[model samples]
Target: MNADTRALLSEAFAIIDGIPDDAIRFGAPRSIKGPTLDDGTVCSPEGWLAQHPRFIERGLRLTEDGSAILYRGEGSASVPAALPMARALGLPLDEARRLFGQREEFTANPDNPLTDKQLWEQRVREVLGKAHSPRAEVQELAETGSLDPHFGHDVPL
Candidate 1:
């Protein structure tokens, strides 16, 4: 990923980490359950984007049915169509696609009763570590003689 993409992912991850587990109900860009938060926040990627100070001008909000994000208010789409999650989040299309897949694979299974915030965050770290681990770094050096792109090159072996 490019620096900007990496930064975006890191920002998103941080926002997610800060949110309490009860506030989260993943499976879509917006919560599958509508208006779960006391403030009517959707509590998913769409909610994250909506809550983000950077893209507040986009006026992105969850549909009443809680399916997707759509522009609301002034400059809103004439048809009020749902925005693509990537576009709403201001992420590059490809990176958003990959991130979505990562979210699915790295997050806890919705059906697993043992899942919790600690377990979910642990899983997230494990997936992230695979990309940044010393073994991955050594393997990259062995194959390409250069580091993979992104921050933190001083990983302990």
Candidate 2:
């Protein structure tokens, strides 16, 4: 079969989108296998994987499928549309601010003004519903002095 790189990218983006506050997918065994190099590295070894753009789209879709199947067909809810992608990924808060600054879509509002994360959460609630508000709250806490910056995401050892 011909490799549809674009389709693959779409799927990966879907996976990334499906997984909120995620750096990588869970439970999918990391597999890297292919050619060999001179450094005794099995060019493709255990947990070998691709993290490029095309693959990311597919990976995210794959996440949506698995999580939906296992969790009563529920999938990743729409995250806050305005929420900075960095916040959802647990990237530094500054990243969210910076990302928002760069987006042509992001605009200043005098009424119903939302901070970077608030704008994001508001977007998320519209699609995912109220249940996801906890995430938004968590995001809020992280922004304030009260919560640790690592508020929403799972910690990796």
Candidate 3:
């Protein structure tokens, strides 16, 4: 990824990390309670992105990510929760869908699920994986005693 994409992903990751678990609701852009920032309302990941101050400043808006718009009442219009992220991060719609959709799977799976924090850490690590050069990472670790400079103390690695 280019520097701008990298930076954008980093910022996106930070914003996601700040959202409390109680405030997050999967399967819809916004819960029926709406997108208010109050404790009552819940939102999907992309929904939260739409409500983010930075994105709001940029005039980003939320829309359902489902096929209900195509058919009258065949299925409910679930959250197309990745669209807003794609727009905010300047990523392709499909790519954002793939990434965030995978995250949802990690949580939604009934057999073996990952906690929200684990999901976030896993995704962040994926991004950081792309950020480092193999040779440079080894040299940095040898020199600074750390592999990830971005989250030396915050994230475990």
Candidate 4:
């Protein structure tokens, strides 16, 4: 999304946040997992999702392999569901609710790897079974000690 639209949406939420909690069941501040900052800090759900339009469309599928990281959903999300799916992933919604006061963070817990390597790799290769091209940004993230490949497939040995 463009900066103007993004700003408008944020401002809209700020207005919505002003509303009393009892007035709404959901709005703004949803929880989601996202990449870590250069400083190794996990980006908040809002920050993570807002990083790009595709995040909301494709929820991240994370796994660790103890060395390389493999994350799917770098772009695009799964089809929308009538019911929330994050809960199924074992992400607690209350934290974001409490922080946003009825607003959702869109992103969930385990924002980013604390270290971004090793266990991360094992996770990606074994868990996520991911194996994007070694030259893909995903692979770069893995090599940088940020993501662990688990779910993604691995390159031929």
Instruction: Report the error of model 3 at residue 139, Å.
Output: 24
How far residue 23's Cα lies from its native spot in candidate 4, in Å, is: 36
Query: Model 1: per-residue lDDT, tens digit, 67-90?
Result: 445655322323322235456555
Model 3: lDDT equals 0.51
Best by lDDT: 3
Tell me each candidate's TM-score. 0.47, 0.21, 0.58, 0.21
Worst 10 residues of 2 by lDDT: 39-48
Candidate 1 wrongly placed segments (more than 4 Å) = 28-42, 57-60, 63-66, 71-83, 88-110, 113-157
Cα lDDT tens digits for candidate 4, 1-157: 3444333333323322322333222222222222332222232223323332233233432223111111243322232211122222222344223322212233244353332222222222332224422224444444664332221122111
Better of 1 and 4 by TM-score: 1
* Candidate 3, 59-136: lDDT as tens digits: 555444422111112223453545545655777766666556544465456544655544654655565585553344
lDDT of each: 0.45, 0.28, 0.51, 0.28
Per-prediction backbone clash count: 0, 22, 1, 65
Q: Report how far residue 10 has shifted in candidate 1, in Å.
A: 0.7
